[model samples]
Target: MIVLGIESSCDETGVAVVETGAQPVPVLRAHALHSQVEMHQAYGGVVPELASRDHIRRVLPLAGQVLADSGCALADVDVVAYTRGPGLAGALLVGAGVACALGAALAKPVLGVHHLEGHLLSPFLSQDPPEFPFVALLVSGGHTQLMQVDGVGRYTLLGETIDDAAGEAFDKSAKLLGLGYPGGPALSRLAEQGDPAAFKLPRPLLHSGDLDFSFAGLKTAVLTQVHKLGAELQARKADLAASTEAAIVEVLVKKSLAALDRSGLQRLVVAGGVGANRRLRAQLDAACAKRGVRVHYPELALCTDNGAMIALAAAMRLQAGVQQPSDSYAFDVKPRWPLDLTAIA
Candidate 1:
């Protein structure tokens, strides 16, 4: 089956095509993405109105690019899939409306996919895909969660952030250091130049004996340190950045391990934008290796929101017989859909 997927969840617009049933797992034929980082950079964050408008302009052209790259035609697409929720309502509507329009035009079935599920299942598209019954750490800009996954659509939320997520901590801390938009990557790059131990940062709830996470406190700590640095903040920005990244990574790595131990799962899959953090990956790799536990992550390119993950998720759900695409063109989006709530009914 040929599935075309569209993603316009937040600051990026993505499109892709996946071929299912030709192999044991679905294969990503081609995908295209357009990041609004540069556009949003001017505003230091995403503007919902601008994001929705950009998605309107970029989704179709990118979908065409994906089809051309995949050597497929629009008429050949059997199912049209789109990220249906947990994003900007306007952005979600753009993709949902466009997808339904396409499905109606082609008389093809359409499927609405949970955005987080796309991230959780993205690793399946990697070269060294993980098997079932794995623990997933879905860390992104807007969310941080630990889930017990038995299979497609089978997810139990082990824990999640109560306040600011890890990504938010990174971004907020970087902003305190006067870093530009998309502060996480900027701070990380600077962190490479200084010592992580130069200034201590808080690791919230590291010993609360629960799996839940809290990064708001840590962000506050960074702010306090920035104030303390005062005139010297510029001279020590790199050290502060390193220290901030260290605190976040330590909490994430330890919490992930805790989730694995609690669930008695031997495999771990880390997905989402924050999963692309080099520090998090290195620490998790080292820690998991020491424990003889297998850790999996999507290719760095796929770590961020993308159409490939959505298409792959839809195909997997279909293969598992957990979802039935609808022929009716009428559709609605859930901007706050929960992953656990997405369990097969």
Candidate 2:
């Protein structure tokens, strides 16, 4: 089966095609992505209106590029898939509208996929795909969760953020340090030049004896330190960035290990944008290696929002017989869909 996926849930406009047959995993034939980071950089954050408009301009051309790159014609796709929720309502609409329109025009079935689930299943598209019954650390924007994934569309939520997610902690802290838009990567880059212990930062809920996470307190702590620096904030920015990153990474690593121990699952899959952090990867690699746990991640390019993961997820669901595409052309989107409840299986 050939699946075409579209993702416009946020600042990126992505389109991709995947091929699935007898293989356990779907093959990504080709994918194209365009990031709106540079455009949003001026505002120091994403503008929903701008993101939606950009998606409108980019989605179809990207679709054409992906199809051409994959050596497929418009008639080849078996299903049309698009991200349906947990993002800007406008952005989600752009992808959903385009996908359903395409499905209708071609008289093909359409499937609406959960954005986070796309991230969760992305590792399967990686060079090192994971097996079933593994722990998944989904650190996507605004979400930090640990889930036990039994199979495609079968997930058991272990824990999630009580307040701010780890990604928010990084971005907010970076903002406090005068870092521009897309603060996470900028903060991490600055961190490399400073000592992780340069300033004392709290690791919130690290000792809670549960998997639930809270980074709101950590952000407040960063704020406190920034205020204390006063005139020296400039010279000390990098140090603060390092200390903030260290605290966040330590909490993430320790909790991930704890989740592994509690779940008694030796395989770990980390997905979502924050999963691309070098520090987090290094810490996870070292910790999981010592515990003899196998760890997997999506290719760096797939770590952020993309169409490939969305299409791959839909193909996998269909392959596993857990879902069926809708023949109806009338479609609606969920801007706040939850991963655990949205699975069709």
Candidate 3:
């Protein structure tokens, strides 16, 4: 089945074509993505209204690009898939509207996919894919969670952040250090040049013997350090960045290890934008290797929000006999949907 997937749940307008076969094999023909990062940079965060309007403008063009790149036609698409919720309501509606309209015109089925489920399953599209019943660490700008994935649509929440997500902490800490928006990548680059031992930051709730995470306190700690440094510590910015990265990575690694041990899952799949973090990757890779466990990550480009993952997820759901939304389906954006919802099955 050829599935056309649309993802406009956030600042990115992503469209992709995915082919799913009966042998549990999925192939990506082509995907096109347009990011609104530059537009949101000045605002220091995503403006929901602007993001939604841009999606309306970019979705069709991106979809056309994907079909052209894949040498496929609109009539060849077997199903239409789109993000249903857990994002900016307007942004979600933009994609939902386009997908529903296109599906209706084509007389094809439309599946509403969970945004986080796309992230969790993203690694399967990679070369070194993980099997089911593995541990998943999902760390994105808006969410942080560890889950035991038994199969498609089968997830058991293991742990999650109680306050700010790991990515948010990285961005907030970067802003305090005078770095611009989207701090995860920028702060990581600075960390490469500095000593990780320069400043010791706390690893909150790491050894709490529970699966819950807490990065809010760590962000506060960074703020306090910045206040203490005053103007004279500008020269030590790289060191601060490195130390902060190390602290965050340590907590994540420790907590993930705990989850793996508790679940007894030898394979770990890391997803979400923060899954692209260099230090976090290195730490998890090394830790998992030492414990005789395997680790998998989506291709670096797929770590963030994109249509390919959404498309792939939709294809899987269709293959699994998941119900399709009705023609009279109304747009419903879930700004706060839980990933463990059984209805998705």
The best candidate in terms of lDDT: 1
Q: Spell out the clash pairs found in candidate 2.
A: none
lDDT of 1 by residue, 1-345 (tens): 999999999999999999987587999999999999999999999999999999999999999899999999999999999999889999999999999999999999999999999999999999899999999999999999999999999999999999999889989998999998999999999999989999878889999999999999999999999999999999999999999999999999999999999999999999999999999999999999999999999999999999999999999999999999999999898988889988752
Q: How close is candidate 3 to the true structure, as a TM-score?
A: 0.97
* CA lDDT of each prediction against the hidden true structure: 0.94, 0.93, 0.89
RMSD score of candidate 2 (Å): 0.9
Stretches of candidate 3 exceeding 4 Å from the true structure: 322-328, 342-345
lDDT of 3: 0.89
Query: By the lDDT metric, which is better: model 1 or model 3?
Result: 1
**Tens digit of per-residue lDDT, candidate 2, span 14-57:** 99999998788999999999999999999989999999999999
Ranking by TM-score: 1, 2, 3
Question: Which pairs of residues collide in candidate 3?
Answer: none
lDDT of 3 by residue, 193-300 (tens): 999999889999987989888999989988888998998568888999999999888988988999998998899999999999888998898888888999999999
Show the lowest summed lDDT stretch of 10 residues, model 3: 322-331
